[model samples]
Target chain A: MITVTGTFTVKKNKIEEFQTGTLELQNASLNTDKGCIEYKFHQQQDAPENFFVYEIWDEMASLELHGASQHFNKFSKLLEGNLDKELDIRIYNTI
Target chain B: MITVTGTFTVKKNKIEEFQTGTLELQNASLNTDKGCIEYKFHQQQDAPENFFVYEIWDEMASLELHGASQHFNKFSKLLEGNLDKELDIRIYNTI
Candidate 1:
């Protein structure tokens, strides 16, 4: 299995938009995408603008597909100019 | 509940030692720590020296307890001089 972690810092004014976009993408991935073992969105307790995504996919191909999915693409556009920086992404395999 | 993500980079020659120490900590956290719902370690596939730890705790107090546990202290000692830098840790709550 592959694990994916994404760190995002949202613009203070764009929290609502970011949250909506993230939830849509997360929900679509889990309910519509295949091999999506787990997908969830989180917000830092001490830093409201800071967010994280923790996802588990059965394999790399599944993760690739998820990225190219329509919902994913739409969500990306919805987040334009809404973040402080490019999403800091990391991928890993169980040790 | 709380979610924690930790990023660690091992020294070039310390991979073996880091792995052994990390596994010991991971196992102890999952098997013995109270309110620890999940604990697992991962290695970045493209960067073998990079490691990630994913953990879930029932509450803030439970997580605090984990930081002071004997196993955690022992694991900390074992990791000294093995890491390239301080572990980068991020904690979050579900949104």
Candidate 2:
């Protein structure tokens, strides 16, 4: 299984808007994709502008498919003007 | 690979304290255990009281072992007076 963990920092006042947009993209991916095991978003307690995205996939190929999908592309494009910092993405392979 | 994701709610004013204690425990586990792939803590953006623990292990047996280990037991006991709610834990097996 392949897991992708992402840490994102939204623009100071645009946190809610960013979350709404991102959640839609995530849910769309989850509902339509066959390989997605889990996709969850988390907000930081001490840092209101910080967000985390945790995703689990069946395999590396499935993850690659996800990256190529339209929803992911849309998510990437959507972040263009809304993010305060680049997304911090980490991929993990189950040992 | 086995992934255990946990969502924990710290008491109203204990977020910082909880984070400090939990991070120490997690670091200790990571340093000592060979089966641990990743053990991370996340705090939610919108929810300041919400904290998430994301852990990946080599297998279920390792996770079970972790549960029985001294550090985990100590962590469990330490939550007695500090937590506002029970730890929400979810386990995922790589497909």
Candidate 3:
């Protein structure tokens, strides 16, 4: 299994849009993607604009497919110019 | 519930020591701590020295207790000077 953690800092004015878009992507992955083991979104309690995405995929191929899914692609596009900086992404494996 | 993500970059010579200490801490939390919902440790696939600790607590009190636990304190001492830098910790709440 592979785990991915993405850190995003949303623009002050686009918080609502970013949240809605991420909710859509998260729901699709959890509900329809068979390879998705866990797909969760979180917001920093002290810093509301900071968002984090934690995902687990059963295989590399599944993760690749997830990135290519229409919902994900759409959300990615929707997020353009809505972030404070480029997404800081990290991928991990069981120790 | 509160979630915490901790990023640690280990010293090159102490990888084995750090892993063993973390494994001990992880096992103790999962097996003995009643309020620990999730206690997972992961290593970045592309960066062997980078470690990530993902934790979920049932309440703020649980997290506080966790930090004061004997096992956790012991492990923390074991890690002294074994890290490349101070741990980068992030706390979050569900969106």
Candidate 4:
């Protein structure tokens, strides 16, 4: 399996907006994408503006498909110009 | 299951040392910790000095024990003053 972790620094005021869109994207990915084992969004306990998405996929193809999904594109558009930095994402092979 | 994601920004020159210590810590946690379902370290592809550790545990008690283990203490000491910033850790319920 492949695991994906993405860290985002959302503007303080856009937290509610980001969460709403992320929940929709997450639901779509899990419900519609094959091999999407897990996909969840989280807010840092201490830092409200810091967000993370942790995902598990059966393989690289599934992950790539997730990136290109309609939900993902819409989510990306929602995030445009609303971040402190570009998304910091890392993909790793599960041990 | 519970998921954990930690981001660490390591000094450029300490990459090798950090990875070595981290590998030992990871091996110990998985091999010895009772409920450590997954523990894997990943280096960001675009940024060499940035590292992430993704973990899953069976329960909160198990995670707490893992945190207080000998290997964890060793790892903590190894990380003292060696990072660019304090470790950023977030915990979330698995979906």
Q: What is the DockQ of each candidate?
A: 0.82, 0.05, 0.85, 0.30
Residue B28, model 3, lDDT: 98
- Error of model 4, residue A19, in angstroms: 5.9
Docking class of 1: high
lDDT, model 3, position B11: 88
Residue A25, candidate 3: Cα error in Å is 0.7
Best by TM-score: 3
Writing each residue's lDDT as its tens digit, candidate 4 over A1-95 gives 87788788889999889878888988999999989998888876567677888888999899888889899999999889999868977876432
Second chain only: TM-score per model?
Answer: 0.93, 0.89, 0.94, 0.96
To one decimal place, how large is model 4's interface RMSD in Å?
3.7
Off by over 4 Å in 4: A1-3, A9-23, A30-38, A45-50, A56-65, A77-95
For candidate 4, what is the DockQ-based docking class? acceptable
- Rank the models by TM-score, top first: 3, 1, 4, 2
| Predictions in order: lDDT | 0.88, 0.76, 0.89, 0.84
Reference-based lDDT, residue A5, model 1? 89
lDDT of 4: 0.84
- Weakest ten-residue segment in model 2 chain A by summed lDDT: A86-95
lDDT of 2 by residue, A1-95 (tens): 66677777888888777678778877987998879998877666556677777888888788888888898898888788888878977665432
Query: In model 2, where do residues sit more than 4 Å from their true spots?
Result: B1-69, B72-95
Off by over 4 Å in 3: none
